[model samples]
Target: MNQDLFDNVRRLVTTAAAGLAARRGEGLAEVLERLAQQDIGPGAFREPEPRSLPVLRHLPQCVGEAMVLDPRLASAIASVEDALQWQQSASYTDDLLGAGFSENYGWAEIIGPRGFFPGDDVLLGLLMLGPERHYRDHYHPAPELYWPLTAGSFWSRDGGPFVEQPQGAIIWHPSMALHATITRATPLLALWCWTRDTATPAQLA
Candidate 1:
């Protein structure tokens, strides 16, 4: 990874990590720290063709609704989606079923054993969602974090009411909690993570 991009990503992760850690918890803070030493988040786009699951088609509905919130972010995600050629894998075909919002939603791996930064057990990605999309209840064993680059997104856990976090806000969910995401404005362009226990994919209720 280029030193400039590396430093930029590190800054984003460190700042985002500290803020999220204070609001969410310590696990996420640690993940950011670990990521600082590796090529995880920003350099994700450094490679022209990185390996990924074959089928990336599962994300359009939920993410599509996000455009109503932030057209710019929606545009960015849409552009990324257009450039991507999905590779089929268990994560696409079998993993995301029952999750809300069918279109305009997408996920790309940034760090993980099979992702941009292989041998880095921690899993991370960029999450794009369209306006008005609701990611219904879901659970996973891995602790998770979200650093929303834009505003107007809501998050909930264990059936809790959705809470709107601000731009640059960090949302964290502990392992196996039933969680969901909803966006009203500024289609989400957020950094996502599963610091550990990434073997278990996300499962929707």
Candidate 2:
């Protein structure tokens, strides 16, 4: 692992978390505080095992738009995009989501069990959904927060109707809350985190 790259990612997560804490309520503030206290030493990170997914084709555009919303984060992410290990949820199959959707939806873990930096009980990563795709409701033991960095994306929770959120919008889902996402004309790119209870994987609702 490149020491400089690891440091840059740490800086990005720290800056983004602080910015999010300032704009969010007490719940998110608490999560950010806990995340700040994690030990992200040189040994915490390993060389990423990169994987190419269809959704990654749209990453350049998403990163370009994200630069306008959060320049530092966008730059930092872009700098290390090729080094991140992109992966799809194990539970999602072609039978679950259509073949088209399965290929075009994936996440890149930045700080988690399989991420560049192994988190003890916290997970931070990026989620990408391609244009005009529906990511059905799914639930997990870990409470989650999503910070969308691009436009034209819609989100829903607890089986509710999806609502469009603008750039820098934050969405929170308590543990085991059913949540889903949709992308319109543009692809979706968001920073996501799971605070605690990171053992269980997400299950489709």
Candidate 3:
């Protein structure tokens, strides 16, 4: 394992947790508490081989935009961007979602089964969506939280109308609640978390 890379990711995770600590949102307190208890040090981390996806092409721009909202968070993300293993859900395909969606969307776990630090029934990661894409309604067993670092994104929950969410905004989804995301004009880079009940994957609604 590259100690430098590992240290960078640790800093990123620490920064993320500190940044989230001050923010107030629905279900955020619970998520923060759970995250605070995790052992993210070297003893608990096992780095996976890094990989990436097409959607990462938008990451630079997303990070640039994010700088306007929170430079500390943006810089932290940029510091370890290359070390993350970006992945997509096997169940998501153009046939099920929409054309081009496969190339335009991906996520990377920072703390979970497939991440640098194995987490227990919890996940903390980043999610990206390229421009002009709609991630239609999907539901999972875990309660979720999203903190978008970029702008021009919209979110919908429980089949409701899409509502624009600004940068640094926290979006929460209770367990099994249908939720969707739409990106317009600009791509999205967001921190996402699942607190407990994480065994089941999300299913399209």
- Which candidate ranks first by TM-score, i.e. highest? 3
lDDT of 2 by residue, 145-174 (tens): 999999989999999999998888888899
Q: Which residue pairs show collisions in model 3?
A: none
Sorted by TM-score, highest first, which candidate order results? 3, 2, 1
Instruction: Supply the TM-score for candidate 3.
Output: 0.97
After superposition, which runs of candidate 1 have C-alpha atoms over 4 Å from their true positions?
A: 1-26, 36-100
Worst 10 residues of 3 by lDDT: 1-10
Enumerate residue pairs that collide in model 2. none
lDDT of 3 at 78: 92
Better of 1 and 2 by lDDT: 2
Task: Give residue 110's error in model 2 in angstroms.
Answer: 0.9
lDDT of 3 by residue, 1-205 (tens): 6788778888888888888887989988988988987888878978787899999999999999989987888888898888899999999999988999999999999999889889888999999999999999999999999999988899999999999999999899999999999999999999999999999999998
lDDT of 3 at 141: 94
lDDT of 1: 0.60
Residue 50, candidate 2: alpha-carbon lDDT:
80
